[model samples]
Target: MPDISHDFVDECFEPSTARAASADRRMHTELAASLHHLAEAVQTTDGKLSDSLGDFASNINAGRFVRPSVFRHYFQLVTSLSSGDIDATKALISKMNATPPRNAHRTITHFGHPDADQISLELISDGMRLAPISDTLAQDFGTLLEAGFDLMQNALPELYGEITAIVHEILLGGAPHGDSVEFDGASHYQFWGLLILNPKHHNTPLEIVEVLAHEASHSLLFGLTVDEPLVLNPNEDLFASPLRQDLRPMDGIYHATYVSARMCWAMETLAASGHLSVTDHETALKAAQADRDNYKKGLSVIDAHGELSATGQRILDKTRAWMNRR
Candidate 1:
């Protein structure tokens, strides 16, 4: 068992939820941290476990002494990931009505009672894949991520499918999926993981995709950098600009900069290729106009560094070329 941190009790949960002694025991742990633990736990080489939801539930329930407020706070945090009034994240997840991953071979488990809000979901196959905590009582983050991908793959089948192909080419140099280096980003095609951020803070799937693409792009550049701790006041120093400034100073620089740029670049590049409709391209253009500082800074970083990969340069050049043509 991993050591639970004291700061987690203080920093992770809301007061009402944290202090409630009779609260749902399964809901009391730090969810983000728990997800991390789930990711690690499911990776064990032990053959005794093939991934049963009931077994996971019994195991976690065994550890239950925490409050339900933790679950509430976790939802509150995830809900804030995107910026909007509609619970788009939840809506997106519901749309998928998710199935177990195609390659995943597992059983489902609730964290407390069989009737309790299902928390940890175990995917047991040749290996174990556990997804801890759901946005709703029925599904957890893994289910949500699968749903999001399904939504994207279906809604913009031609577009996202192509982007996925592009990401694959960049990361694998046209190699087959399982043959490539392991991916451990917020959302990766391998392992089938996607970090579902709150809709209120992010607002759109495109925005989320932008962040995901940045992480994907980083895999093409240098290998993923050792992530830094979140510094609440990273911008306290004037050097924290996503452009010109070194993104390495922040917790998720690739998401903060490169993936965001790659997303924009990909949208614009698609338009340039005449695959995206003019109106859609115009929408992408309008967004760039609306966030001129971010657009300009992203371009500036590419130009200043001359540091992007050939694929990265193609994305940057294509985006800029599209801007000029517009």
Candidate 2:
């Protein structure tokens, strides 16, 4: 496949530094007001809100009283919520209703596998329309997602919680248009709360777990770096990606490396759990090794070209430490 990294970067245009700074400030103010309004509306209508909504309000209200890192994480969600237009809000509300209640059995729709007729073409913050899936495809995708969910719950519950909270929906789609390289999945900073997956590319449960871990890592970084850039350099130069044949920007390489480390962790966990068949166990081992090697290469590129801010440095250090663990 031809490399389309340059085109992809161009298409996903970010606001200029000055404009972004102003937007960030405005977003913080708007988000705080929005949260208060949502909380008040819920209280007036329902007498009491769900524990999740209650915690959400409490966290936002606690403000600086909470740890800076924790506050920033919640702020990301607040910003996402505040940016939603009326249609987006309605769509989100409908999806939330379909979300399985905590501690309850998950249905096909819980993981975002809505029936064919129920699937609506919604536009994401990045101005791309999410693709709809047929009922047969949704059912097949749901089954794999459930297996992956169970593995995550048993092996990595904390990671699972973070991912589910950040990713409000998982839209099924083909490879992104205009990209010769086939993408198994993609996530955008503007759409910080969604993931788009090519179900055809990831048919196995183990494959699904890898993609989930990878994309969710991007979501986590998107939230943590909302106020700053991960690297100081411009996206002018294209560098070889360790995970793929395409050439990508330093930032993309950083994301790939970070997520590769997470993928390695997931694979190692599954391999050690003895939960897979002999063939599957072998595949996991091979995949884990490949991920580790690519991670190392990606990290080298970052070390050479990245100019991380304080928050970015902390995140990088943590991922490096995770990769180094026995």
Candidate 3:
């Protein structure tokens, strides 16, 4: 009995010290550095740290937070799996700020129509892993890199060459900021990695190349290694539609003319390369054309009151050209 008691005590003592040391090691190296880097990056995007944690919570709920270090460890795990995204975050905050706590579970989600999916910020860390996508994709990316380009250093590509370069960098490192973008579709912005639409969805390398070029165009226009600071703080409405109270009043109308036009140019480029089918091109083209009225109105208002830089004018011109062509 005496020997057994002593063995148990020794076993507990040794492991406790080892565990403590392991924890300390992580704190000193990876954890601390990553946290600091994240803090810095957030400052770059949001312009201040006074409400960073709160902003982080908002981004987390909106499926907007995408820091790589946060992804690599429990730091990201807690935020991604535990919080709601933008919509949920707003509702949660509204409820919490209302005066009393509700009876909802600690893990909460938003509900919509029956057919629509109710998003869950539950157990996200369980499945997300960053690993090799495919040897073929990697090889293509490498070839682009060997051609003397760095995704982080250049403007977004007008062609496939630049897109390939950007994708390689994203695979090797990660996005310039957050992990992904959730604008109706789940695409990663230059905010994280350089990704276009999924290749599997389209089933052709040419199409993949075209999508890559389109997204890369954003990377160039926005920023190579980091997303530009928002001209105005964006919220749920902006995400859903650029036409929102917060959007600039173009003759008292908030619209997404510029974005629609740019996307048209990109898709048109893809169609021209035979990367998109005529059907797909037509679909995308119609969408762009639909925005023409909005664009014309917005441009009129902007020209009246807002200034357009040389580069901005060029982007709009190219997009319009792409849309106008058959």
lDDT tens per residue, model 2, 181-228 = 666777765543556677778878778878888887776666556456
Model 2 clash pairs are none
- What lDDT does each candidate get? 0.35, 0.60, 0.34
Which predicted model would earn the best TM-score?
A: 2
User: Which residue pairs in candidate 3 collide?
Assistant: 61-84, 61-85, 61-86, 62-85, 62-86, 63-85, 66-179, 156-220, 175-192, 175-193
Task: Indicate the worst ten consecutive residues by lDDT in candidate 1.
Answer: 167-176
lDDT, model 3: 0.34
Ranking by lDDT: 2, 1, 3
Instruction: List the candidate 3 regions with Cα displacement exceeding 4 Å.
Output: 1-158, 169-182, 185-214, 224-258, 270-281, 291-301, 304-326
Tens-place lDDT per residue, model 3, 197-269, is 2222333333333334434444433321121222223332222233333444331222244544544454444
Of the candidates shown, which would achieve the greatest lDDT relative to the real structure?
Answer: 2
Error of model 2, residue 86, in angstroms? 14
What TM-score would every model get versus the actual structure?
A: 0.34, 0.63, 0.33
